[model samples]
Target: MEYIQTVLFQVPASRLEQASETGGLLAELDGHRAYLKQQPGFRDLRLTRSINNEGNVLIVVETRWADDESLVRYETAEPNVAGIIRKHEDLLVRDSLQVLDMEALRTEASFARLESAEAARSRLVLPLIVPLGVLAFALLAIYGLSRIYLELDKGSAVGLATGVAIGILLIAVYVANNPRMPAWQVGGIFVVVIAALAGGTIWALVQEDEGEATGEPTASASPGASPAGSPAAGGGELALTLGDNFFELAGQKSPTLSVAAGKEATVSLTNTGIAPHNMHVADAGGQYPEAFCNPGGATPCSDPNLIKAGGTATIKINLGAGTYDFRCDFHPLEMTGTLEVQ
Candidate 1:
């Protein structure tokens, strides 16, 4: 095996000029090189200097040999390789002389061969693998977010999609950088963070809705002044009000409209707020059941009437004895109520 010897010494700045004038250091280095070159199996020698932050200069000598036998012969006392070293002892820092021996574990040829093989695999496999990975991540994010979109509003849906995308990216980065991490732990982190983002977003939206509904009256409370649990006159007109975040009936916030079965009723939606809104009435949970209505109207809804402040849209519905849900489709996230058919 090839052997290497490294020698390190610190030379004081005070002696640099004196040593240079006398050519003492250079002559000593030349003598050592000549001796080592003539030795059997000697390969090469290198000398270098480095300056540290403290302005101190470090001298280094590296000698290479073809085999361990040559290195051993130079270190042993029989050859007396200490003559030049003794001459330089006074110029070196106390205890600064250090000698190290190293055996080569790998050669330049071995490194070159390994690097070539790696490069070949990377060129062939990386193009296919990278695109496939990106496609897989995209599909996973879409599938995961879609499962929760129905329960969220438009803003919440977008937020959820963004959160899921970020989470997926983080998982990819984590897995790529930390291959030793347990698979279950990686999945657990992703699930926990994603769920937290979804739940927190939903809760914040609900709180905002409630706060807006309670903070001020955006519409005329008189239109929504109808009492809760009061049965509407059978087939009669029921007054309603649409505001920024409320579906008001008879001047009350979210008043439940009770109407008799097998009758027709008209819900007059008066927009008394800055934002425009329309009323959409469907079965209890927004299931548009096959409830027959007036011609040209599939669901019980008004055209998205851009009712200006104080404008109104009258929606007539054929009421049946069943529970139904009513909401302003334009602001469905916060404007909604229940319709009870007795």
Candidate 2:
């Protein structure tokens, strides 16, 4: 294996610049190179200087040898690197020097092949990862914002969404203007914003679920009062409110509707939520045979069309005394109720 020796030292920036123009340091190193070339194991020599124009300039001198035995033979010689650098004590920074000896781990050709393979892999992966990461973040942002907005009134939702957008734009502008900002600070800002959005979305959903579970009405009920129980013995007309993913009857979620047997009953549906909804009652056998029920169908009863937010629709129920199932077509699993025909 090859043996390498490295000498590291620092000089005052001003002194290095002056020495370069006057060939002071360069001439001394050239004389030293001539001495090293006459040694038995000398293979190659390199000199490097830091590009940063800071207070001190760092310099590195590296020498390669054929093997450890040859390097050991040269180390015992008289005109060594330490003796050469000692002559320039006035130019170098105080105590800023180090010497290291190392054995080569890999040949130059193998190292080059490894570097080329790593670069190719990076090029292939970065292209796919960047676009996919951007797309996923965009989708998550949209979903989180939608969940938060769904809980607010129209005016509040618009105002909050606009403010959030403006805040994001301002942050983008700040990051663009301060390109030298620390990476950790930028990452912390992103993490805080995303966490805030996720927290708000979760809170909004929890509040909605709590409200639905408590059977709170989103809209005003009819003026006439019926005690909090099943509809009147012979249900003439009953009013129901459709909220987000739920149905409310007289401030009761998924309530049962009772009507006298062989009598006609009318149910008024008022949609107070953002999503469209329609009521569909199953047939006598408690089965919804049709994929899309028609209002004029012979079996189960259903609304002719979906009701938009703040819209209203009516369905007539007339059947033999029995129990039937009813649900909203748009949110069948979440918004369901029982119809009791006594």
Question: For model 2, how does the per-residue alpha-carbon lDDT over 1-342 read when each residue is reduced to its tens digit?
Answer: 679888888888778765565457756776678888988878988888884455688888888898898887877776777667767888888998888999988978669889999999999999999899778778778887877776664457789989998998999899999999999988898788878878987987785676454433423444243343456566666777778988787678998878677877777777778676778888888788765566777554446456655556778888898899888876889989998888
lDDT, model 2, position 207:
59
Assess candidate 2 and give its TM-score to the true structure.
Answer: 0.38
Clashing residue pair totals per candidate (backbone < 3 A): 7, 0
Q: Which ten residues in a row have the lowest lDDT in candidate 1?
A: 288-297
What stretches of model 2 exceed 4 Å from their correct place? 1-103, 106-118, 179-182, 216-238, 243-342
Best by lDDT: 2
Give the range of the ten consecutive residues with the poorest summed lDDT in model 2: 214-223
Clashing pairs in 2: none
Candidate 1 lDDT over residue span 1-342, tens digit each: 579888777777777665455558646676667678788989888888887666667877788889999888887744323445557677767887788889988878668889999999999999998898668656654554443453354456688779768967987897899989987896688578656656655665564455346434533453455443457665666767777879775557876877778777666666667555667777656675443223236667754334444455677677667888877666766887888888
The lDDT, on a scale of 0 to 1, for candidate 1 is 0.67
- Look at candidate 1 and give me any clashing residue pairs: 223-251, 224-250, 224-251, 224-252, 225-250, 225-251, 226-250
What is candidate 1's CA lDDT for residue 133? 64
RMSD of 1: 15.6
